[model samples]
Target: MVKKIFYNSLFLTLLSLTSIVMAQKQYPINYFSSPLHIPLYLSGTFGELRNNHLHSGVDIRTQEKEGFIVYAPANGYVSRIKVSAWGFGNALYITHPNGYVTVYGHLKAFNPAIIAYLRKIQYEKESFEQDLAIPKYKIRIKKGDTIAVTGNTGGSEGPHLHYEIRDEKTEKPINPLLFGLKVEDTLLPIIQSIKIYTEDVLHDKVLEVKKKDHLFSLKSIDTLLVPAKFSLGIATYDVISNTTSKKGIYQLELYVDTLLYYQHTLETFSFTESRYINCLINYPDFIKTGVKYQQTKILPGNKLSLYNKHINNGWIELKDNLVHKLRYNVLDVNGNCSELVFYVKKDSSMQKIPLSPLPIIDSNLLISYNKIDTFCTEEVKVKFPAEALYEDILMKYASYPAPSKYYSKFHEIHNIYTPLHKNISLSIKTDTVADSLQSKLLIVRIKDDNSIIAEGGKYENGFIKTNINNFGKFAVLIDTIAPTIKPLNFKDKTNISKLKTLEIKITDNLSGITKYKATLNDKWILMEFDGKNNLLTYTIDNKILEGSNLLKVVVEDSRQNVSELSFELIKKVP
Candidate 1:
């Protein structure tokens, strides 16, 4: 009884300390206004699980249309503007006086003043993509000032404003909702299913789940009767008011009887640790079932900061035939919550299997966390550096027939489902390829849908070498074709008097475009490239003359295959 009391006291002390620390970290609520003019609705929320990182910001809905005016939420200065083909294209960063920075992404166009400044830099540098850090005094903003217009510029599927609030000092993203950015949300998070797994002496075993009307029950009730150790996970999501998009839960608390056994709140996280989301979920299950199940029990390798007050890493050990109550409390950012209750009892009817060493499939395996691991086969070799993986895993390797288009054999380094903290070096020998095609050889990754992504590699010795993070079907392919360039609105040597811009579509058949340059009358001109549409646009300005003008465009592929287009156009002042 005394030992139980001591444990309870320690747990309470940790819980109280967590609450106090959270309460002390305050923010300037009501200092910022809604970034959009329309009613606030969310397409994505902060802390949401994404492909390889947590969604660091909230995606504000813009009525499913582009060109909506986005405003400055607080008084700040434009810290930086990043323009890219993917990953938050045309994003703006502003540093405020309150030690906070606001980010606005997927913008169609900036304000006229800002646009002029950016265009000047683009022309000076002769580049379309740039990461510019502006001085604070150069561009100042006031609260509610129009900054930019929203669009689906980057990796977005639709029109929405990706907004974020980050700590200026730590550069860590904090939940924007914590700063009094209010949205209508009354719906509680819904729990769709639950999973339980056990790590017995024999090996790890997966337990089956039975679901009905959103209530999940364990199919292996007989296994729970045995006194053993187990862990749990949940498949749940949140729906904001007037939005059908499923979002991540903000907080989760697991309770044993009436005491809090474990708790995790999505308050803030570092940008570096964002990739740890893969370890936070049941990655193997997600790969097989296509459902994301957040593991309630922290893995031994997981280093995410969201978990706190964890008792025994959220793993419950059943030692006696006594019934224990389990409760799950899930909440949204708006404080709306849902509760789930269940019971577990120990039974001795289930027998425990004895432990035995399994036979090693290959003697060349290096399965240790302390040192770098290197695995190889006849056709392919992989080199994993120290700390590339969170824990030691039995690295799997296999080689099969390559696709009809590929020149080398298909190599599967491991399951694509597993996440890696760092990249692994992959090398494939190309002895089968003709010597003439060696210069055009490069590695390509084939997705499940048979789509090809060029993993640019260089030929060294007799092998094509490159760094890869995800494990999939990889093989060597040759790219002998040059990129294609065609004018979209005008033909060569034609009058473009009424046209306000020169637009060209650039495409590549094999390797993607590497570099492109546009020149007018043998002088460099700034051409904005929108990667999504494969369009290169040059707005007519003082740079163009009234008479017949020569425009030259040169595009190069990854293999240095170049294509050039030259045209003379007659322009008149409107």
Candidate 2:
């Protein structure tokens, strides 16, 4: 009794403290009229779609031009400056005293003041590609003060301002629209269709909606019964207020007979979980064809902590005459919500649904794979262990039974090691190939004539013997040689002074140069590599000494073969 009283009093005290924080510390919008003086149009609004993660910021349209002056939304100082090849070509981060960090990405160039500051450091470091983190006190700006100009840089699809605000402390991104930013949205969310899932797919029949175009109604359920063992996922998207375009849903709530089962609010999520978007949606189908289908499987392996926590959230057991009611509430950021409800009848004894005329799989064809970097295609088809792949965890295709044994020195099986038991040898059969074809095999291995360190052996149709193994780059033509450097003008033995710059033409026979480092007298010199030209050009920049120098150039391939050389030369100042 004493503990309960103590807890109640503490809760009330904390509640009073929370009320104070919600009032005085409001969003920072009092100073600036708008991030842009132009009619507030968004080329990409908050929570839009992207190739990977959901677009976190609102992209203010720049109206097709470079060098439109970008202003500071509030009084703040620069906290970070990062320049990269893919992400924000030129991005600036400013942290306000009121506790919010506004990020501006894909800028053409910083204002003169910021430019001078950045260039000085870049020259000091002698590198154009760099990330700079500076103290907030170093660079200050007032609201409406011009900070940079708009430009199509980095991975930007076009010229626009990719702006976002993150909590200074938590660093969690919040919807900028929540801060009273004016956006015209009034349309309600739209539901496309619903789907029912059962673990007894092999024994049960599926119920198809009799009609289309409108929400299907249920004929008063006399406690509709469905035998146990199944889950649910819906096919739906949200419709924004000002636009007719289809967008992702903001929130999802699952309830069983008015008792909440599961809920997930997109109000906040960490950036680390963003990669798990593959687990959140149908990753396999999404990769094959660029369409997203949200899966509602609540696999136990899923590590995301965003699921709504409640006793009844998203699970129902089958019982006789039990009417399982599932209510799904979908909402958009603008507060528009769409609800979907249905009754499940508890059927006696599990039964299989009739197979569709078209089978989901074909045992005849090999699943061709393709990629440039990162993942090596392990298998063509991946079947997860119930609710594993699409929703809870991204399952990788692993093969079994040592795949590399077929590779003999006389027989060219380039050191291929199939991914251990991780590879999936999907049993497929073909009539023409026959079971005898299993003896005929295609030997695959890591590139570069490397010996098979690990491998997998599998037979499809009892005839097609396939050797695949360990997940890694299969084609291993290791470029054991360094980039062949040819000076466009500088003769190896001759004095290299007829030129104002030293240009070393370099090329790797195989997996081209991944990195190159040059230095003069042990001091780092910036030499840019133009992959297209196969040239490493080092001009007589301001940093170069106007005297005798020893220049060293080293180039390495992706496989880590190094070719290095040093040149003794005298530089004459122009």
Candidate 3:
């Protein structure tokens, strides 16, 4: 008995040593620190659940609030700064001198120098969001400088610093924890469900591997079947130590009957193929239902990637009745791992679907229907052509109510969620007028749930087309939410020389702020308002106000929430 245990231990040690020697991991670490004062208090670890690309960065908790002074992780410069409402509200990009850029997202504000510089350029260009690429020598910075204050900004669900490190040349996002951010976590990863994706060209496709007794097995009845010699794909998520929360697995090593076939370690990845995530997972099947089934095989037309090490073909060439032993390891920052063992016996099983669609629904799949004008989840989107509201609303009753925009051509594109209902109604409430010309000539179509093609066609009137297909949400965006206003350093019936700049904050929940203006005694003043934060500021140098100046401010949101404030300020000439 003792000899058997000893040999098992020796075998594991040798295997570990072999993996270390054979598997080449380029730790993308450039610098080091314990992101938090005492250590790391990560509420969200790297590769956690997110809308896209697996959580790229870890969210360092701020003790339940914002205003933590954020410093540069390494020597870098102000490479980029993004100020927006929904995601990464106010973010700072600092490019290190060492061919890498450290990113800080969801910030409150930048330091004085950065603020002044940003405002100057914003006023000069008269635009809020302008991406500037300065020479590394131009926008320089030092380590430990208070670059930004932590806050709940952008697409943040809470107040935390969303930090990341990206390779300068390849621009691949690497884990900041790799750079020596001593996040004192001792927890090993948790192994969740192991999923297998079988190839299917007809109808829908999905399969699941569940655990029973001490072993994992496939679902008894499934339609997903693969042919002999045709490879398979596996999708799995891992957890970290000190937390059993599922996270992105660093690497998934595949062996066919103990013969190494493929190794996919996320040490680095290109931004170009990021969208291949849809292809990597069983996207269409996952959309129709909830869970995901990952496949190990890289299908044709899928330019995703295969960081293969041992074999030319990452997938195994199977024979009839091929029984294979598959092993997957889940690792954390310190390389501590948890192992999951499973077997795949060649079986041609198919998935079964009931003909009846889910008849009940919770809400319409709505996206970014509030303050700002979000076109198609992109920067500039067009929600007209009124036809999206009527007969063409795709899907039964699928809905993704998350209203956010993505960067794309023509301003932006605000995507709707999948439909979960038999039908839906798209209602629009505009402030003044819908661009009837554009809205009239526009044709509306929806990307349905089951089908990859955008279903529905040009419909008359403002009705969204409806169906039993699964297209998450429906939107013929005509602004409905109002813009909100917050005043900074307010004064009433007092001499106003004390405050040089009239700073007012304007924020819109949705379509964002379309237009904003501040007037003293009914006259225009030179001031800049960052629509991202809804902040309005008028430097006293631009326009002088006389005695008992009536300060009037008007703000309009995408839904056209016009808020006007009137106050009197007395100015004493120095």
Assess candidate 1 and give its TM-score to the true structure. Answer: 0.89
lDDT of each: 0.81, 0.56, 0.54
Ranking by TM-score: 1, 3, 2
Q: What digit string (tens of lDDT, one per residue) describes model 2 on residues 1-574?
A: 9779557435533442343343223565554345666655556655444554666677776876777888887888999998765677789999988888888898988889888888788769777667888875898888889999888777787788888888889887655655655656555455555435565455323233222222233334323456565555555666554455566666666667756566655545566555445545544445544545455665433455455553422445665566666766666555555555578776666554555453323332222222111122223322222222222212223333333333221222211221122233322221233344333332334434554332223444332233342233332111235567676767644455566777888877654466778888898876655444566767765555566677888877654567888877666647
Q: Candidate 3 on 339-437: residue-level lDDT in tens?
A: 545555554443323355434342222322222221232111233332122122212332233233211111112234321112223322212334542
Residue 163 shift from truth in candidate 2, angstroms? 1.8
TM-score of every model versus the real structure = 0.89, 0.60, 0.65
The reply for model 2, stretches above 4 Å from the true place, is 1-33, 41-54, 64-66, 200-227, 239-246, 284-291, 309-313, 318-325, 349-475, 480-513, 516-557, 560-574
Q: How does model 2 score by TM-score?
A: 0.60
lDDT winner between candidates 2 and 3:
2
Write one digit per residue (lDDT tens) for candidate 1, span 1-574: 9779557545643554455347335778899898898999999999998877999999999998999999999898999989987789889998999899999999998999789889889878888898999987699999989999999887778899999999999999999998999899988788776666566523233444454432334565633443457677778888999999899888877777677787877889998889888878888788878778787777666788888668887787877777887766677877666655567676555445555644567865645544688887766788888767767777767787865777788887777877787788999987566677787899999899988999888887789988998878888999999999999999987888888898999999888998999999999998878887888989888788898899999999988889998999888656
Which 10-residue window in model 2 sums to the lowest lDDT? Answer: 365-374
